[model samples]
Target: MRNLTTSTFSLSAFLQRTQGKKVVLIYPWSNLKTQFLSSYLDQAKDGILYYRVPGETVNLVDWIDGMLNEFRTVLGDKFGKKTSAALAERIPAHIGEALASDLGAVVKSETILYLDDLDQINFDDEFNHWAQAFVSALPEKLQLVISARMLSRHPWDHMVASGDAVVIGVETRKSAMAFTVDTDDRPQLECYAFGRGNILLNGKPVTTWEGTLPRTLAFFLIDHPLVTRDEIFHAFWPDLSVKDATNVFHVTKRKVNERVTSRIDDDKQYELTQYTSGFYVASEKLVRHYDVQEFQEAVQQALVASDDRREQLLYQRAIDLYRAPFLQTVNQPWANDRRDELRRLYAVALTGMGRIFLRKGEMNRALGFLSRAAREAPEREDVHRDVIRLYLEFGMIHEARQQYDVMEQALSSSMNLQPTKDSRALLESIKARS
Candidate 1:
């Protein structure tokens, strides 16, 4: 990996070498980062979607929306208001249809999607699904470059192994903390609690728990930080004596630590910490990460951001963190309430992001966020109302009325409720305008 064949990775050379392939996964050496690559891709005159996966968690819809913003940036006037609206309206289930329809005409001159900072991100079920469909359905001329800190369970290996992709590497000067797991490399620790449970350390799965106790302990620390032993005992083994629960807790914690840090140096391993309060928490300094923490932080940041643009971006960031329910398969007591709260917060973030876009005059983009919000929380009349208003604002009266009817039906059927007064007023205004 240290072999220095070139000073810098040449995109033109890479493309030329891998002829007729739409997807190219460039596994640059540990020294390589997005800073150098971003400059190279930004120079492309035709088109490019240079998205830096910023957080530990990313939602499929938010990821697609970020890409769409770039697609819109590159296509310019060709992707006008109506086209943008149409593209934004595409559901996550039909994102391929939306991308192909919007980009078919613009990808004639070698459009590229540079997904930077791949190691800092985790793919949820939606991301995995969209990525496969998006890549497979892409036009022959479109190219994709995924730059990650380390590789895990993404389909890049299959692409390379199947002779469908060309993997290139940069010369290693000093290895950065991140790299796409090479033939001999491995990720430090990657855990995904979004859909199904998956835990990887050193590129190996730690999903098979020694018992239910180990899984419970790991997830407890993930949701509740600095939890006291008493909290753990009461939550899981309340029926047992404190001494008994303490024994069980210590045993389970040790097993989880072993799984996470096996074959790794003690100094480098991110293990659980115990305080004088008998509270245990995961060390913050380690290479370990939690999707729930990432998602919550983004949402909190967005909530407090002062600038409109910053808030908009942060809100979208927060929305992206919620890919699935918190520890979807984990049915423990600690997981359930937090899962419901985050789900509610996710809906709020979606609604807020859409409203932000609406205020900025990006009607189509606003509609997209609102539409997703409505889908996420069908019972949230506020989201449905916003979608209807967005359609009316975009001069799509028919779409607005259609959405209103849908919302009305949903409210009546689901909750035995009717639209709120504000929503009824908005619909009346739309009718008046029509």
Candidate 2:
């Protein structure tokens, strides 16, 4: 096994060297720690920065303009002037072009360009062209770091081969303190094993427990400390009625007893405990690491920041965190509420980003983002309205009409009412233009 401390120290040193120099760090998707880069940059007396590229569903032009405006606000008059001019020139073309021209200048001057979550950008011919141009435009003094979940198969490999790039992989290790069950004795006993793989019961390894059900359940409980027994039952038996669900609890308790009662010594208690309505997995010392948690926390923190700073933070957070719907495969009713919440939040975030793009006159990017928001939240009148407006603004008459029809259908189905007067007026205007 590699020495984690030594590896981290060496990586830190390598990162420090890239400060004030044109170096691209291509981080793997699995490594989702912004703090690592922030700490390294802080040590090297470099500032941490972020950017919000319009998503596939948003208008790129608008997103660029909004970002430039934000840059102006954050950096003050002098830096803002230079950045804004560059952004204005390149934004109309596409994010790649804009980033290349604008960020290229920063790199040329020996500034660090941290492209966090570069994996979110869809890889296509146009995107590839933009990436190539952007990388090609980088000056020797500029340090460009692109962090993503996974490596793209196309131009990314080519870029890494040609560019001065370093790849880093993050891996997880078992918790230092884990439970053990030993079934060697006539009555197996459970014990706490420190940094060992298997559980020991009565000084012997427990052979009966072969699967990971206990471990997985324990992990779930630990992560969701507030989770209730009702939620668990629902997750395990989604179709069961409330009365029938009591049977699930009884069955679960039996399983728990079978595992804990037999293993625990007469004087000791079971690791899993029931308090009030929920079960608690007693592994407080055990710490599990997940990349998704890091990503979610980063995005959530950014979103909760002040409204003045919300746009850029939310955009950056959405860009980095939204790999897919949270826990995509966990189809439990308990998760349904959270899933819906995240979906709504994501749609709002996208729409907020689209508004920024629209304000910046990047109509294409704005339309893309707004359109996606509309699709994600089809029932949301606001999202549909925004999409229709963007389509009309860009002289996409047919698209505008289509969006209006969608809105009409959605309003009729969901609310049992006609489209709002404002929406009707906008459609009328589009019709006149067509």
lDDT of candidates 1 onward, in order: 0.63, 0.53
List candidate 1 segments past 4 Å from native. Answer: 1-50, 53-115, 119-188, 263-270, 392-419, 427-434
Clashes of each: 3, 30
Model 1 lDDT tens row, 231-308? 878888989998888788788888877766663555555464445446565453333445555455445555655566
Residue 53 lDDT (model 1): 65
> Candidate 2 residues 161-272, lDDT tens each?
6645544333232222111211122332222211122344333444443244443343345335455667776666668888787675566555654555455554645544
Q: How high is the lDDT of residue 414 in model 2?
A: 76
Task: Indicate the residue-level lDDT of 328 in model 1.
Answer: 80
Model 1 alpha-carbon miss at residue 370, Å: 0.6
Model 1, poorest ten-residue lDDT window? 172-181
